[model samples]
Target: MNYIWDLIIKSERAGIAKRDISFAVAEVYSPYMELSLESLNARTAERRVELNPYYRFDHIFDGMFDINNDEDVELREQLFDILIHFLADIDLTQGLNKREFYIRFALRDLENGAYGDKVMRSIGLFGREERDMIALNLLRLYETGEAVYLLKDTMRKVFKRSTIYANCEEKDELLVYVGQEETEEARAKVGLIMDIFLPVRFHVEFYWNRHFGILGLEDTMRQDGIAMY
Candidate 1:
């Protein structure tokens, strides 16, 4: 995206602004501003890929277990540690300092050798399609109504298996049935829907390896008095 910073001139005695000089300066400094803008965008997830793809994808998976990604948390911690250590001594009295100091150590504990689950090789980059998909999905999440059927539909799009709500009868609580095969990314999306999108008055909980209600046999499979489960 070609961009330029307009030069404004306001002089009392000699108001002279040459188009040729203005064009030349604009041409020279345009690239600098472009790079500067990109550098500023480096601080954000949407444009972080331009400077570092590793960091961008790491934010998506909340630090994948891939060593290739540090699971994402390691590199950030390393840089933060160097900056914190620069303070001469990490005094745990200051709130920000204390949080950063302890959080770094706790994250390191999550490393856990990365023996079998180390993220190796490419976990893939965040391209235009992934970005667009997320945007569209977010639109669906926000636009979709908050009824039982609507919530289930949104979850179906995110997870392969159908998400059964157990506590639908209870007005104040929602119980989500869980399956073990879901990916971390999928779980993260589900968590976002439950934690961020759900109304404040409702309590959401997840239960695994159990069914909360009686199973109803499908009408299509019922024949004579016996039905397939």
Candidate 2:
């Protein structure tokens, strides 16, 4: 996501140190670094086949040793794109958690300056109940080792749907499919979740089929520009 990177660049320009940005970026991409080269090759190849039949992973990984290396602009850009797509395609809750980690890293480095305050407000800092919920859920996750399941369950209840789908898009926004039910109600539920539960800084969108399997099935209802809670 260029927007995420742009935020880092903007923060640096706003007086945050380059090392801090690098550290945050490193943390964001650390999950990729842990994967084996063979695993990366296979996964990237599979993704390329689905996305671009003509794209070759070999060209991107041929001489690439470090993705963070800046000497070869082409390699770096390609690798960054791969990582971005990889992150986008993963589980929604996991992706948002990683994003939250990145935001926290930036905030820690920025501290209490004007830029930091702006970022803080943009991310919607947690209040007492939200903070307590986070702590309680973390403990539950540690004890049961089902953190994703817990989040998915909470989401299911909030949307009033037994089966709902969630995905993180390329723009780092969360998209939730709430079926063909009451769209306004779904929006309100999402607003509440964003306000009380979401720990990360990113936008969310609710998608529904307005026509409900009718002639206008191709047309989808989308609600965006949701205010941060």
Candidate 3:
């Protein structure tokens, strides 16, 4: 919980501001793959009752997260509940709906990491088996922190911004142009342009809090797993 506060403050300072604080909070609390399978299984049980007040099989069949999309009523219910629990437990603010929040944030994370294609392949919320497998693999990467870093690196490459200064008369207006050259050298040393590595400072500071916070998450790292330096 202390880590939660630190993240809030860090994000607040990093241009996140108060408007999207709940979203940031939800992102920080989201569980990775290292969490026990039993936790997810337990959530499934609880979700069944909450989602299906009537407890009817046919009506809620389409809502289940299944590979086959078959009417396996029992398994479907369990899957739906587990997914719901996984989503709800992340953040429980009054205005936020669990399912909607998860889907939206997941999309943002994917976009930030340039993993949109991988996420699409996983079909996580869309109920596809291949996509589910990819999601599981990606979760493993997240547990190791490699996935997060991988996404960060991709983001640095994708939305890399630059500033250019041109010598002009006092009355001359500024002009901006997009680069058309597809060469590495051109991309690297953009003429009259000052290149700066823009770090997503919020993520870095939030991770610092995550590393030092007393969540036992850092301690769970083995030599084979992720380690904070």
Candidate 4:
């Protein structure tokens, strides 16, 4: 109706009262516009039923899981409705998330109706931190396994202690100078990360360079796990 009035402005007369004309036009146009809008919405919802998965439209997921693909027609319909409606409670939005990503992955994969049981029992599979770690591992899967790069960038990220040094000694040994503050857990993780990102030729050794011995002197005495400062 407002649009009709806007169109009428372009054809308004210089000196005439045509408010009555607008009222009559609107009386005819408003119902037609309302009906057209409703029909358009209905058409859009119908499209979503074929292209998307949500609520009643979730029948798009039929024959997806093993239960839905099996010969038991009654069981398939029951389980498909039950599972989708249950997961619908977790996310009601008609948009994609991790849940949708898995669904799409299963759809595109050739292992049709294979991972249904796993998806049902996949309580610990798609946590945010877990997915983030998976993504990071994939991104760094091709990092150069060089010693200099390890000392420059990789070790800093994997180790807690900031003050550290690297040395290429004779006999194919790489000497690492580290503080006593680093924990054994951190040390082990550093070794694992280095093993993944270091060439196999170099033997890595960690020397805790904080003085901790009976002499208690810097750069001289040696203890069980501590070396010279």
Candidate 5:
């Protein structure tokens, strides 16, 4: 994750434009977005909730946490604290949306320099195969439509183990907490998803503040003698 962040920041020095950085990040992290949508569908099915309700996955688009990063409310608060450090570390103009941000950053590294090269090499992620695998799974779930109906069907089959809906308003919040806290298995599932998104969250503030040219980062970098690099 540090490697990804380093590549993003170094892209500026290597002559990678902010636009490209945004594009790359979006492309690479696209799977997380798909996961968010699929997870939302799963929750709905579990609760016997109606399809295409007012609170679609898009409604919970509260940054990557809605997908990968944060956990419950407390964890989300903690993540914001971490975000502060990242904001203080980068430079830029106006931050792009999440999708745009990832693509541009990844492309920046690919086209200009190799700031992330060693790490990717170490991980054996030479091309887009790994990226595509993640992205494709999400797409497959989305297109199959089975993922959307999975929870409901499962619940009907195993009624005792299924969760009941309390209120639609707190649906997303409830789903996250209950799924993670109700059973050890669920907790592991949540943690696994969290691990998937942790890298993105670690670098989120770096993208936002730097891409948007937040004034404080320049001052912080200068104070710490980090601006020279």
Candidate 6:
């Protein structure tokens, strides 16, 4: 919970608007919880649900954080605090929904490390037999921006001689440009390595020295013995 508050404060210091920060938090937390603007409005307007004393926010707003309204701001803060605590207490190994479990798992991984190569490898093995594309897509979308930032940092470290620029062109596509010349094998290797770390639905495209390309994931089987992409 403190981590979430710290993130909001850090984002504010980094010049991100309050509304964007709210949306970012919503993006990560909404999927795990039954959160919707309409439901929140209705619930908060009616008799308060007594989940906890500190979590008294009626509902989360759609876009703007409404900083001008003191109650609204306070409610938003309370809602986030409530969510963080609620999510933290959920037992992932119990009878939780698979999607919720994976989303929570991925969020934990991201917070621990920005889905680095080693973390990705571990998650890949952990989820190797799982094949819920929708859940994976949600995780990928939530981490897309951070993944780009981490990818750029990784490229800077790995290819010091080359200037690397990485950007998320769409929700699911990452475009990476390497200034120096790279062989076909080198480009494929870069793409393949990143593909292994990213969500199954997300794709990475590499462009270097006028060459453009992408890597493909191998067909794999799930725990149910069904083949998956």
User: Of the candidates shown, which would achieve the greatest lDDT relative to the real structure?
Assistant: 6
Expressed as tens digits, the lDDT of each residue in 1-229 for candidate 1 is 2222111111101232222121111112332242223344332222111112222223533433344763546566445334322321322223555544444443333233221123111111222233233334434545675445545654555544546553546477766655444566556556544543465676776644333443473522334433122
Q: Global lDDT of each model?
A: 0.37, 0.40, 0.33, 0.39, 0.32, 0.43
Sorted by TM-score (best first), the order is 4, 1, 2, 6, 3, 5
The order of the candidates by lDDT, greatest first, is 6, 2, 4, 1, 3, 5
Best by TM-score: 4
How well does candidate 4 score on lDDT at residue 173? Answer: 58
lDDT of 2 by residue, 54-116 (tens): 123335444444556669676665665555444433422353565466544444433344333
lDDT of 5: 0.32
RMSD of each: 19.8, 20.2, 20.0, 21.0, 29.2, 17.8
Q: For model 4, where is the 10-residue window of minimal lDDT?
A: 43-52
Question: Model 6: how far is 226 from its true place, Å?
Answer: 43
Candidate 6 lands at a TM-score of 0.24
- Badly placed stretches (over 4 Å) of model 1 are 1-134, 141-150, 166-170, 181-186, 213-229
* lDDT for each residue of candidate 5 in 1-229, tens digit (9 for 90 to 100): 1222333445544445333432111222333332112243332111111111112234433464434554576665445434432432442324656654555555444334343443333222212333333333333444574432333333223223333222235333212112112444443333332233232312111111112222665643444333211
Choose 3 or 4, whichever is better by TM-score. Answer: 4
Task: Give the lDDT of residue 203 in candidate 4.
Answer: 71
**Model 6 regions more than 4 Å off:** 1-146, 161-171, 211-229
lDDT of 1: 0.37
For candidate 3, write residues 61-144 as lDDT tens digits. Answer: 443444455577576555654544434344334465665455455445543545545433323322222222333434445456
Q: Write one digit per residue (lDDT tens) for candidate 4, span 1-229.
A: 1122222222232222233221110112233241112233342111111112222333665335443355766665456445433443343334657755654453333123232443233312233333233234323443442445544354454333433444455456555555545675556545544543456776766655453343655443544555543
